[model samples]
Target: MKKNDIIITYGTHISKMVRMVLDKAELALSIPKNARIGIKPNLVVAKTHDSGATTSPLMVEALIQYLQEHGFYDIIILEGSWIGDDTKRAFSISGIEKVAEKYKVPLLDTKDDTYCKIQAGPIEMEISKTALDLDFIITMPVLKGHCQTKITGALKNFKGCLSDKEKRHFHTLGLHRPIAYLNTVLHPGFILMDGLCGDLDFEEGGNPVPMNRIVAGLDPVLIDSYVASAMGYEPDEIDYIKMAAELGVGSMDLEHANLMVLEKDTCPVKTIRSRKVQALAKAVTEKNACSACYANLIQALARLEERGLLSYYKKHPVCIGQTFRDQSGNSLGIGSCTCRFIHSVPGCPPATADILKGLLTGLNTK
Candidate 1:
């Protein structure tokens, strides 16, 4: 596969799939044999791959085996799970630790790695020192929906390389522009996406839709653009993908991309958009609500849907953020920014459980 091209191989035999793509792309010839390679995979939460929230261990193992075969031994598996989750726990739960042990490759938890400030375009963010020192970075991100960004792929996975403080700061910076800026500075050389089974609605994953395929590519922006299309969305729907393209990260123009399919597509693309999420989002009046706070609310609504309780508040809107500062009355509110509201759940970003409880009680009262 060429830089602008994407290859999709169908099946669960991850190792074989990895080998096929590497040979097809002749990716080894592009990198220095003795280069220090860093492999970053998404293990955002302490959950198994079956939960559709993390990268598959089999894929990572296959990548390690392929790289080792090509004489690349100075490889490290690195990741920093999202702020509130433990990276160690994610490694254990996602079964990546066993793969690391078998390959004799050290696992570097970026959560514990020291970071140094780096300027990427107009943005200056702290990135992991070890990540900065790598000769080549191979990104392995799960293709999944995101509450804030609409979707998370190759570019979004780089957030793991930042310190926990910087991760939070990205949210404060409104996520999209900062993400685009970060990629300008910290670009991954290659991307092998874990697309076997991914959640359709949330980044943290619960609903696993088995697509039974692995996607490989070199262009991060193009890869995300293709993923956005497969997941029933245009690339422009994801703000960062468009922003990154404008910043010259890569092209978001799928029409110009060289898309290659190695095997027949077993799982045809379906509209994975959840109606419950749509309805709940319609009830949300947000103005700069942070990703965590907004995601917690979405998760809470998902839980309510599971319990068949979503219909109760179908017509009720939830007010959040600084814009609703002195707002009150019938609408339920979330976060400390909505303190003046009578039914606000108080926290800078309320806990998921608390958000759930607030939804149940606040909506019931009305």
Candidate 2:
């Protein structure tokens, strides 16, 4: 299969799907037996894959089994959870540690590992040593929407390899160009997107939209572009994906890329779930809001509407993001970005439950 070739195998049997893709790609012949392979999965939170916040451990187990069957034993699973979350806890909660133990594959927490400075253009970031040492890298990212970047797929999953300090610094710098630069420098041998159940609008995952399928590809940018189209977005809609394409990481031109299906997909690609997110975001007075903060607010409102407590939300816009700084009025704000507002939900990215309660309290006080 060409680098631009994307293969989609639809089924609940994840291991079978994984093996099928590898066989079709002829991955074993391409790499040496003694090569040090690193399997990177998105484990941003201490949550199960069913929650859509992390990669499926079943998928990892299948990949490990596939490698071991092909005389490849030098495999290690590495990841760092998002700031404020524990990587070890994420591994345990996501059942990745158990998978690692079963396969006798060591697990490395990038959070504790020393980092080396990597610079691409003006973007300088610290990446974990294990990430840099691997002979081959396989990324398993949960396909989902990101509040800041619009989408998180192959390229964005590498953010987990950064040190906690660098992760925060990436936010301080614009996320788009840095993400592009990161992918430009660090290359992944293959990408396996966990699309069985993923959050429609949140990278951290709360409302999972089930679409049982495994998407395997060699090109990260092409995979991300296809995911963009599948999720009701143009490739250009996401700045980072476009930027990555521009930086020569890979092609986003899906029209030219060969998308093959190993079998007929019983589950057709759909975008109806994201429309609800668009509708919910309409009530948000947002400007430069971070992904986690915006996602929290949306999920909180969703919970309220579901529980019939949405009536408690006053008929006014709920403001959020850095653009709301020093802004005043009766507007209910969220996160530290809206600290200037008297009526605000606290935290850099406040908990979804806390956001719901804060909004309810604000309404009652009014």
Give me the displacement of residue 252 in model 2, in angstroms: 0.9
| Alpha-carbon lDDT, every model | 0.81, 0.80
**lDDT score of residue 228 within candidate 1:** 75
**Which TM-score value belongs to model 1?**
0.74
Off by over 4 Å in 1: 266-366
Put down candidate 1 lDDT per residue, 190-213, tens digits, no spaces.
898998776666789876555566
What lDDT tens digits, residue by residue, belong to model 2 across residues 160-210?
Answer: 999999999989887888888999778898888887777876888876655
